[model samples]
Target: MSVDFGQIRRNEHLPARIAAQIGSDIQEGRLKPGDKLPTEHFLAKSLGVSRSVVREAIAQLRNEGLVETRQGVGAFVTERQSRTIRIDEGELFKRDSFRDLFQLRIPLEIEAAGLAAVHYKEADLERIDEALARMTGSEKWTDEGIDADLAFHRAIAEATGNDYFALFIGFIAERISLAIAAARARVELEEIVNVTIDEHVVVRNAIASRNPKAAREAMRAHLLGAASRVDLTLETY
Candidate 1:
């Protein structure tokens, strides 16, 4: 039976709602394992939601281990009982997802920052600097600023001289993008924007100076500040 996307109403929780419907489809075998889901654009149009909403819904499924995404191809249901690992809804942007996402980043990124201090190349420094410049020059709390923020962290991950580190951080960043967007919406924008830039500058400077310990500490401090801004308590996570 064809899914009637038109019946889905628009609401604040649209992405979660969409994810639930698709999840129900998967569970019922209407969308069997290995079946390719509709294109993001098609799903967006059909559901009367933006492409980002569709993307987020798909990302949610991916986190749940209910779906797999192949580059240049669409998402497909994961083979039944094949998921060895899965992130539940609480680990997403729902209640404490941001906290969980930040916790996931702490160890990995702290290590990356240290490695970047030890191993970063001139080109890596340039990319990081460029991202920082973009953040400093862009409007506070805008989507562009958020992109630049993610880019700065990604540059540090790349500087680790490990393909796996960059790849892993990139994956985590994609999953957390919506969480970051939501966090950005809840705070005093202008204040947080300037503060975030300053925090980044500290991290960048430590990396530039080739101080591994300092870089690690700076990165830790930066992330802690971010968590505080979002009202996410990371101590327990």
Candidate 2:
């Protein structure tokens, strides 16, 4: 039997419940990155809700940056949260069962990126763009490049309507910075830096279109790719 969390209704909160379901799936490893979710009709049927409700729920998850839906490919798990990421001296060291952390973070970042695409106030965009510009301007390496990179992510988190996301992401900033450093060092790809700006642009465009699914997908790709770098670097460790 399929599971559902669709009882949340008027005088209720379907979106939150839906978010919880998706979030739980990631945490439990029931869903992996790039794994497609049940279709709207299937989800609606499983959850005992109208297709509109399912879509709304999916949009909420997309807004949270957890799942991405293709135009006709249904919804896929773009990213998942990690359980632990203790960064020290610019390295992303993983703790036990670290999968949980990514599981938690994916949805949040995706939502932030998506919202940034839409609600990213001009000032916020300018702030991020400035950070990007600074990153590009630096031909020489400065440890502070990490700060610029993080600032860009913070901008996306801030763009989300939910203040909690910004707060949560801020709490994890130190470790995330370390992770970024480690990943960048491993990939050694300048495009990672350059593409950040481009990927952000893709995410921004999706949100601007109010295409939550698209926004989530873009965010997911960026993050999962980040995770892949971690995998690559781990080989040397």
Candidate 3:
């Protein structure tokens, strides 16, 4: 049998069809907030779907918080839904998917730390030490913690003397913030930051000691430790 993508959409079962049309209507602003949807029967007839299908589609929208239903009145549109969607060649923004971003972070960060150990200058070490001090006095480990934490990592990346890898660090900062925000508590944040600082110091010390292998090892330990602490589903990757 032949297949047509457009026909497939047109022939989709009732619930999916209703969902697509309503979703499209909302997308096109034909369905504005406070707009009452037609009754289930009307929708079913109009869309050539069973009333159950209409109800199911409405339920789906309700679950998405795009519509509100009164006890005996009707379903009305709500504000348009928003999703975590953006494309910056390289930039960080608050988002809902940090796990995916962390997948890109730990290894890149650890590797950058190792490189920093090899290539960092006295000035670089001083800069990193200053950033580290900022972490030492921090109280709550929330957004402030995330800022300090990413800053420390960025410092290591800068110490690496590689600009592109540092760009990778910039890419995931916001995503890491999401996971960091979901952490155990403020103290937990401080603890992780402290632990990371220790790891970073070890890496830096190894580099300063001119032990490249030890620097790499220390960097790896820091990231893997972070993975375990964060329960990063992406640690294995």
Candidate 4:
């Protein structure tokens, strides 16, 4: 059962284009969770791109939480949206909507941060680092950077070694992207970008040091900071 990927058009961002096509396949249910992806070699040949391009595209998909790769096994579609709450776009634009999303996330993600600090494997740390690098290097308010920011949080969720944590956070993050993008659009301050980078660094460093308490606090503070920047408040939950 080989996947017949269409040939890619010539583009400056080949990997992104390839990733979009594969992501579309997953979204459309042409690919389902646990379904194995075509081998990099096969995808490269069929798509008329280098293996490196395919590899990068796969990495991008992984960051987007649309796919996962095993140590010796190949890539597979991730479990996403199987039990997701449907978010309404009109509600997502409401002034308080982002805060509502964060309120639900804070407890779960705080626990996830602590658990990740205690349970994270070396590869999990590497994935987190890679996502952080992408966010830090990206242009402020760009979709690519926002994707990386979301990826950073999803990596933390995965590091908890709980599949449900990853699955839930991945689904939630996808929905919240609409709000984050809208919030970013209204910002006039460039300092927001630098602050975000520093905040992520704090969380990353705490997790890397294996300090569960510090990781939890850092994660909470970061999320709180994000809410503050967006003019949202976190009430007692």
Candidate 5:
């Protein structure tokens, strides 16, 4: 069966949008299991995007277990039974899923912050500072701001010296960022952006000081504040 690929109009989150489009094609049976996907060059040309965007989209599908690449060949759809944990981005923004996912995220990130405080190298600190600086400098409620926000969290996870922590946090943060961007769209108040930047600064300072307790508390506080900004009422501990 031939897949009907469309031109990508929006510039923001190009890889994610492409991944979603191709994933929908798979789920709807336009692309069947074991069927090889078009080459990166073909997809880029058909979709009016760069080859790098197609590559990133394919990477996302691979991470979600929807596609597998053969060495020196091409990517193919995976059997449904062999697929791993799949997160539907559309469903994730629903209120219950958003709140529940945020709850699960809290403790994992708090622990990561503590571990980062103890384990972070100078380079890790520099990465975190750079992300924070970008967030502080960006326009309020923009995609660039959101990307910087996620980068700050990802940097902290990387600093933990645990590959699993970085992996899991990176996965969760990618999904959660979609919901966060949606929430920001709804509430585009300058005050909220200022508060978020302040919260990140506190977390950065705690980690830099090598204070595990302080780092954990700062992370918890920042996350809770984030929930409030999104109008989510998560149970506070």
Candidate 6:
């Protein structure tokens, strides 16, 4: 079968863009389940990208359960009728897209924090504390520190006793972390890092106190502060 793959523009996150485009094809029924994807060499040539980018894009589709690869054969669309939610990384760089994502994040995370406050076990608390400690101990401007920050939030999501919550928070947090890292790049890194740590501490303290309302409010404040740090203006409600 002939596939009309578009040539990719040179930009950051090339692989993700390719994956998003192919994923769109799958979701829209243009690429049926069991339809084999073009070879890496062909995709690379068609898209005007390197074979490595094509490989990574295929890897992404596999991770999202939209595609399955057979050894030495090729990649084909998965038989699953539904595709998992995916945020196009390229869109995250756009102002409106970032704002929309952050807006969605507010209610979801606020609720997650409240639920965590109500349901968190001692072990959950320890995980949260461990992540916090790692963030505090790591270099302020390093990827390790950012990862620790994500872990801290993930721990709270896990504490909610909801696997879906954990899954979504993990996905959204990963994408937002990219935006956060970019924002941090343009400012006083040390200052932003310190403020972020302080905000996390407030959220953690509220959860630890087992006050759902307080935890919710703390999370709201922290998320709002995060958006502001990124120079994005979001409605406060």
Q: Pick the candidate with the highest TM-score.
A: 5
Superposed by TM-score, candidate 6 places the C-alpha of residue 213 at a distance from the truth, in angstroms, of 1.1
**Root-mean-square deviation of candidate 1:** 7.8
Tens digits of per-residue lDDT for model 2 on 153-192? 7666777756777757754543444455555554545766
Give the lDDT of residue 193 in candidate 2. Answer: 68
Model 2 spans with C-alpha error above 4 angstroms: 1-92, 189-191, 195-197, 205-211, 232-237
> Quick one: ranking by lDDT, best first?
5, 6, 1, 4, 3, 2
Using lDDT as the measure, name the better of candidate 4 and candidate 6. 6
lDDT by residue for model 6 (1-107), tens: 11111111232245656877898898899999989999999999999987856775685676577898899999989886655766666566666776798888888
Give the backbone clash total of model 3.
0
lDDT of 2 at 200: 58
Clashing pairs for model 5 are: none
> What does candidate 3 score on TM?
0.52
Clashing pairs in 3: none
Best by lDDT: 5
The per-prediction tally of clashing pairs is 0, 22, 0, 0, 0, 0
Could you tell me which 10 consecutive residues in candidate 5 have the lowest summed lDDT? Answer: 1-10
Q: Model 3, range 1-237, lDDT digits (tens) per residue? A: 112223323333344346546866865889898899999989878777667557756754654456778989989888655321223312222222434565677678767767877788988787777656665665324334445555666677778898766656654543344344444332344566667667767866776776667877787776666655655545453
Residue 164 in candidate 5, Cα distance off native in Å: 1.7
Q: After superposition, how far is residue 10 of candidate 4 from its true place, in Å?
A: 28
The Cα error of candidate 6 at residue 154, in Å, is: 1.1
Tens digits of lDDT, candidate 5, 58-93: 866876778999999999999999876678775664
**Candidate 1: stretches off by over 4 Å:** 1-91
| Per-model CA lDDT versus the true structure | 0.75, 0.59, 0.60, 0.74, 0.79, 0.79
Deviation from native of the Cα of residue 216 in model 1, angstroms: 0.6
